[model samples]
Target: MKNNFSHFLASLIAVPVGLIFWVLSSNIFDIHLFLDVLVGIGGFGASYLPTQQIFHKKHLDKYKLTNSEYKYIKEQLNQADEQIKRLRSSYMNIRTIKDAKMIYEINRIIKTIISSVEEEPRKFYRGQQFFHSNLESAVNTIEKYLYLYKMPGKSKQERMQLHETRLSLLELKRTLQSNLSHMNASSYDDLDVERELIKRNADRSKKRQALLTNKLDKEKINLKKDQAKEYVYRGDKNGE
Candidate 1:
């Protein structure tokens, strides 16, 4: 092979090059210098060969993922994308000051999740675990926000908005939990279930978004209808 030939050539050249340097130094100054040069060359060769072999092995191994593993990884990536989309949509719709703070915390959590999913496979499990921890923290923050918003004295509109936002937060919590479960269950050979889980989670998120959007639209329409009815009632009373 070309690689073997190159290694052979390198070894051949290294000995002669080392010897040439030794001779030149000896001729100019001292024999001890030549002996020290030879010792140095020996030490270099001893360290270099094993290091080169290890590096070569690692490099070759990096490209050898099983097809199923690759598919599973791709599925996880898709799940991450879906999560980001949902987070961005939810963040844009956030209205109240309390909800805005929750959005900020969710944004941080989503960023961590995205980073973990993008990390090299060699580092994935650890990175994903850290991401899951952040997600839990985000969930706790949302729970606290929901609790604070549930107190007395809120306008009807505020209460409705809080209820919808709380629903979104619960959906997010479910998605995170599903993702963490998949990450924990994943392995080299049996990733089929993990892939399915991710796909299912993404599907659930899409459904949740659709439901939230529809509900928000309905609420807006109902509010307009109620205002129109109130105006009509007042006009009829005045005419009477």
Candidate 2:
């Protein structure tokens, strides 16, 4: 209510103040040309735009998420930011180009998602589950890879374990990449709320699939029996 009143009051005063300035400036400069009169009017109108929006925060209106949704997303973004910082601090100690490159790409994706969420929080909120799960997994896998690589390995088993971990981390990175399509912006903002409904539907679908599979298996068995009888009939005819 206060904000609305402030905006209304600003609008009411802006034009009059502009007109006063125009009139005073025009007469003092003895401006009489048509273009000059129009320019004076526009100048005053443009000057008040800043004051008109002074009460609002810039770029906040760009996001369409509800306040609660925004709060949740912002919390996740802060966690991703801290993970990125940790990766950066470990950069100098990264043993391989593969690790360094993967870490860099992880940083890039985190920043990109953060910016997208800030700009259009509602659009990306549908993928909140996908985003949070995959992003945290990626960060943890990377951190584990770094730790294992930095540890000194004297035994053959330790070396083998390090190799296996690297391979697993690579697979984790690929899995994260594959899930990126789901992390993209979507129109639905209530996806987090609808997760339970989605799970129920998925369960029903699996049950239906299982029922279909059983029906098909019975048909296959019956068809095989009929084929066997036909083969016996054909052999009897040949004997005749």
Candidate 3:
């Protein structure tokens, strides 16, 4: 919508272009109506968003996706982002510690998927697929359960249903967690490698510093030994 010169140009040209084609065909053949319609469609197609969507959009480059994949994945990512936003709205209304923790984990997973795609799209795409599969159902299930829990005056059956729903949501959360566990494990391995690198550098630095200190101490001791011999020789000469 922002820089839609094509649409504006189409709006300006379509009528004149259609009319010109109509007049030319009217003189040239009896198929003026068909020509007019064809030109009109061509103008509209040029101005359509789908045409623009397939073009090499620079912003989508960050995700490292092809034009088609960019469109598809961007749509899915937007849906998940919206769901995460809605879930955040319920933070203050959360009742139990367990529910809060569940929400935190879900947000963590969603945010990680979003970040990982920008940095490492290939590695994070599996997480993206998992998100697409679960996001809508998980949102509905959690929100519906929370809504029911908040509403007053539940019958015995409704109470029973609430408990069942809670169990189901718990199971769903656990399922999502299980799928994300492998991703978390890979991250932990990366952290371990980084930790070892830092430790090795620190060890090297300490050893270098200790070696310099030892060398300086030996030089000082040798200087003192040489000075003592000179003093004894000068004292014997004075006695003579």
- Give a tens-digit lDDT track for model 3, residues 1-240: 022544455456555654665566666666657775675565555545443443335435544567667556666666767888787776766777887787788778667656565455444456754666776777777778777787889999999998888788777777677656654667778999999999999999999999999999999999999999899999999999
TM-score of each: 0.31, 0.48, 0.59
* Candidate 2 lDDT trough over 10 residues, lowest sum: 55-64
Where is the poorest 10-residue window by lDDT in model 1? 1-10
Ranking by lDDT: 3, 2, 1
Tens-place lDDT digits, model 1, residues 199-238: 9999999999999999999999999999999999999999
Q: Write the per-residue lDDT of candidate 2 for residues 123-159, one digit (tens) a residue.
A: 3555565466867776676677677678774488878
The Cα error of candidate 3 at residue 197, in Å, is 1.4
- Give stretches of model 2 more than 4 Å off: 1-62, 185-240
Clashing pairs in 3: none
TM-score, candidate 1, is: 0.31
All candidates: CA RMSD (Å): 29.1, 15.8, 10.2
Best-performing candidate as measured by lDDT: 3
